[model samples]
Target: MAGLTLSQASRALGKSKSTLNRAIKTGRLSATRNEDGTFSINPAELYRAFPEPSRNTLPERPKEPDRTTVPDDLGSRISLLQQLLEREREAVADLKEDRDRWRQQATSLLANQEAAPAAPPLVKRHRWWPF
Candidate 1:
């Protein structure tokens, strides 16, 4: 009556009742077998074998927004997205300008380059020593 039941222990530990029952049967955890054939687990004993789960283990649920603030929230989000889009467009325009400037420089350098004169052909000479 004082201690936690198997189901209660399972819920607190974020595990199944069958798991706790198995632990008790396998001597991994200690529990009392009640007259009604239910387990009466001591909080200390249960925790000693299986520590309570940390708060970080549970997933966080998002809070629902107020109905009246929904429209304002949407407006703010849209404005922020628009600002980001404008910044991205400006960056792309700057990159395009740089690319155009580089292309013009390359074409000008190629056009101004002078061709080198061709070398004269060499005549073959006969060697006197065969070795």
Candidate 2:
């Protein structure tokens, strides 16, 4: 009556009710049956049967990485990225210039072709055959 009930004992011991019930039934843990048919286990006996888990044996969680601190190579990485962007811009400019030069050469060639006179047809040479 003054001791922990089955549920309370199981919760405090971090074990299931069935486990404690089995322990009590198997005589590994001693408990008094109350008039209401619920088991009342003594804290001393429960601790003796299943000792409290030691906190020291658990591994400590690693501390979270600090986001505010800047890395040592930040400046170098930014400079390298800037240099790459500049190189890409220069390459694009060169490609545009080459494209314009090619377009100009093609238009000139077409103009020259149109300006040349057309050759006369061979109708006179074939006229003797008659229609």
Candidate 3:
């Protein structure tokens, strides 16, 4: 069994590197690192991860295909998404409010700093201990 680098495996497997990484992360593919800190992959493992059928090994299925109909949960999903988006919008508004508050506080601090008089510098004391 020939081992391939992650890039080589992706090219040979016709999959992107991110796809391969996701495969490894999801336990779909097994990978190992080379001594050079590069990934070494088994082609067999890649194949097992994303198997391809040769022309001769193609499955024979019925010509008729089932029609795809949207599930009833789709409406609820859309509504949930809408609600999530509204929540996100509210969060953004809250963040903006917080940012404005912080900005005002920062401006006040800067103004106060400008209003305060400068203090005289303290003289440095010599240390006797040598640690």
The prediction achieving the highest lDDT against the true structure is 2
How do the predictions measure up, each by TM-score?
0.40, 0.41, 0.42
| Local accuracy of candidate 2 as per-residue lDDT tens digits, 16-51 | 999999999999999999999999999999988888
Error of 2 at 109 (Å): 99
Q: Write the residue-wise lDDT of candidate 1 on 1-131 in tens digits.
A: 48899989999998998899889999999998899999899998988899767633444335567633345456677899999999999999999999999999998887766344556688887789876
Better of 2 and 3 by lDDT: 2
**Clashing pairs in model 1, backbone N/Cα/C closer than 3 A:** none
Lowest-scoring 10 consecutive residues by lDDT in candidate 1?
A: 55-64
* Runs with alpha carbons beyond 4 Å of true place in candidate 3: 1-70, 129-131
| Model 3 C-alpha lDDT per residue in residues 1-131, reported as the tens digit of each score | 66888788788767789998888888778888778987788877878877864622434334446844444465577799999999999999999999999999999999999999988899888889865
- Winner of 2 and 3 under TM-score: 3
Cα lDDT computed for each candidate against the true fold: 0.83, 0.86, 0.80
Q: Model 1 scores what on Cα lDDT?
A: 0.83
Q: In model 1, what lDDT does residue 127 have?
A: 86
Q: Where does model 2 exceed 4 Å of error?
A: 55-131
Candidate order, TM-score descending = 3, 2, 1
